[model samples]
Target: MAALIDAIDVKRKTTFELEGVPYYCLDADISSPTARGGQTLVRLRMRNMLTRAVFDKTFKASDKFKEPDLQTIPATYLYSDGDGSYFLDQESFETLQLGEAMVDDALELMVEGLAIQIDLFNGNPIGLTLPAQVELAVRSTEPGVKGDTASGGVTKAAVMETGLEIRVPFFIKEGERLKVTTETREFAGRA
Candidate 1:
């Protein structure tokens, strides 16, 4: 049987179908009645899971949206070819090619052989779910200025194995592995 959902139960980071199109629920908000007799409404900010188009919408409590038919498959990150990132699905052994725009900056947090979640909508690759943190090897960075103390408030720019640059404490050096936050692309700490 097909899945159905009430608008009130919709949550962020999940996809729900409305008007027969699947949308990623980025955020949901409920409005308090301004006047004593005013009707309450719910607002949603959503992105088209396939086309990447985003928009805001208002809905009533009784609105029904189909739960998106999605499957989460485990995949291993392969290599990138400048224009796209590739992944090998564990179950099917099929390579999924996602364009740079679709992959966005998430690739920075992924390295070869990393386990990742691929979201398939109607059996087509739609998006990814990444871990909160990843460990990346530092490729290069300027030598810390002489005498920068461990407790001092100074940071140096370092390039990672994935070619993304981020500021790290002066104590960081080339050839070290550091944990990075996937969402903000910031240095977390040594791995």
Candidate 2:
């Protein structure tokens, strides 16, 4: 049997089940009552594991939730086809094909052989979690002018091998490897 967690204990990344559906906590905020002996409230921004829907709701601090049966397994990007994207589970060596809606924006950051974690509910793959940063090879960019820096904070558009376009320093050029933040899709630094 899974354990029950109080609403007041919910935090970012917490996973719990409500009414037989699993939800992941994206953010949580607690409000203290202004008056004495008043009810405390916990507001949470939650995402549905099955439908990917997100919403915010408030619950009493005493509310309880059952921990869902969830697990994250290491996987490697295998390839993509007309059907969907494929991944190889490191532990069981099984191939998983996720639908377009499931892969979504994460596909733009993926490269062949990239290591990532896949969330599994019960026994089925549910979500993809990318690393905070990823190294990608620059596919193309314009040449940097010698005095480009004179203007200060000069940046140029660059395309990565995976077709993700992002702004990079003027000095960045084709074939160079660069670190990029997955959340913001911004250039971090040279790989």
> lDDT for every model?
0.87, 0.94
Count of backbone collisions within predicted model 1: 0
Clashing residue pairs in candidate 2 (N, C-alpha, C atoms within 3 angstroms):
none
Top candidate when judged by TM-score against the true structure: 2
Superposition error at 95 for model 2 (Å): 0.5
Give a tens-digit lDDT track for model 1, residues 7-44. 77777887888886789889999886879977677899
Show how many residue pairs clash in every candidate, following the order shown. Answer: 0, 0
Candidate 1, TM-score vs. the true structure? Answer: 0.87
The 10-residue segment of model 1 with minimum total lDDT is 144-153
- The stretch of ten residues in a row with the least summed lDDT in candidate 2 is 99-108
The C-alpha stretches of model 1 lying farther than 4 A from their native spots are: 32-39
Tens digits of per-residue lDDT for model 2, 1-191: 89999999999998899988899999999999999999999999999998999999999999999999999999999999999999999999999988888898888899999999998889888889999999999999999999999898999999999999999999998999999999999999999
Clashing pairs in 1: none
Candidate 2 accuracy as lDDT: 0.94
Identify the runs in model 2 with alpha carbons over 4 angstroms from their true place.
Answer: 31-38
Q: What is the lDDT of residue 109 in candidate 1?
A: 80
